[model samples]
Target: MSAVDVSLRRGEREILHGVDFAVRTGEIVALVGPNGAGKSTLLAAMSGDHPISGGRVEIDGRPLDRWSPIALARRRAVLPQQHSVGFPFTARQVVRMGRAAWARTPRQDDDDRIVAEALTTCDVEHLAERPFPSLSGGERARVALARVLAQDTETLLLDEPTAAMDLGHQEEIMQVVRARADDGHAVVVVLHDLGLAAAYADRICVLEQGHLVADGAPDDVLGEELLGRVYRYPVTIGRHPETDTALVLPRRPSRASSPSAQP
Candidate 1:
């Protein structure tokens, strides 16, 4: 999927400012930035959920608006920042909804098998029979991801998928995301956790004030200097001792000198 010079507006307010981005198949691009930097807005535009006032979004070289809704659903799936189910739907039932796009097709017959596989892949098989509303936040997050995976689309746009998940679950979710990209899927995810982005993202796009400021490999784009400047806090970037993945941490502020010690 590619977004060229994309600009989105709501009334007189502009959310995204001519942002240009593309993610090739088999790539995982993490969008990282301070809050309100337009990361989610960009994802919404690329997913065709929000209209663009200028520029264009294309999938397979065709404009997003030109593709039929059902046809486009088969090529891309979006997991937004907030996922809600109003009814008392079980996890299995919720995931089965992902197959709605295939209704009336021969593939519809495979919905059961696909939903089960998606549940297991997302580590939510054990929660299959549980009511979605009864699950914890982390459990709900995993179930939501299972629903997305069941769609089985080639391109995925995820918005802060790890939100409300525990540390172990967060890592597990990111591992699942990376595995999908490795399987030749194009994955673009919004991430507030710089450490997680550094660890799992093949590429990082840094946005600041609705502008794409930096884009490159994780190590190159997530340098301590750049992070301190963008995030407005001292940070240190290091390599994990065992896996050698990028590790990011905030530096503690130094204590101010006492009046007696001052010159």
Candidate 2:
């Protein structure tokens, strides 16, 4: 998916200004910035869920508005920040819903196997029979991801997919995303964890105050000065000893002392 000169507005309020972004097949692009940055809005605009006041979103060299809803669903799947199920449904059922977009098509024949694979891939197989509403936040997040995976689209747009997970699961989820990208899927994920972005994203786009400030490889884009300025906080960037990934941390004294830091 690609967006050119995209601008988003809401009730006379401009949220994004002339953002240009594109994700090629088999690549992962991460959107990163401080709170209220236009990352999510840009993603939504790319997905056609949010209207753009200017510019266009294109898929396969065609304008997004030109595609039918089902055709669009077949090309790209979106995982928003929140996961919710109004009805009482099992995890597997929630995933099956992903295939609804393929109903009446030949792809529907693969629904069962794909759903199972998605459940296992997201590590939600054990919870497949559990009620979605009954699962923990992280579990629900995984199930939600499974649903998106089951959709089986080439382009995946995810928003803060690890926000509710523990460290291990966070890494595991990104690993899934990385593997997906390696398998020729296009992925765009919004992430607050610069370390995760640095570790897994092929490129990181840094946004600040509704503008695209930087867009490039993690190593090229995640400099200490740029991050500190965009995040409006002191930060330091280093290389991870084991993985050689960027290690970003707030520049604060180890014992510096806030009541919030106290257990």
In model 1, state the lDDT of residue 177: 95
TM-score per candidate: 0.94, 0.96
**Tens-digit lDDT track for model 2 on 1-263?**
89999999999889999999999999999999999999999999999999899999999989999999999999999999999999989999999999989999998999999999999998999999998999999999999999999999999999999999999999999999999999999999999999999999999999998899999999999998888889889898889999999999999866648667788
Model 2's TM-score against the true structure: 0.96
Compose the digit string of candidate 1's lDDT tens values, residues 129-178: 99999999888888989999999899999999998899998999999999
Candidate lDDT scores, in order, read 0.92, 0.95
Clash count (model 2, backbone only): 0
Give lDDT for model 2.
0.95
Error of 1 at 5 (Å): 0.5
Candidate 2, poorest ten consecutive residues by summed lDDT: 252-261
- Model 1, runs deviating above 4 Å: 254-263
Model 1 TM: 0.94
Q: Give lDDT: candidate 1, residue 244.
A: 85
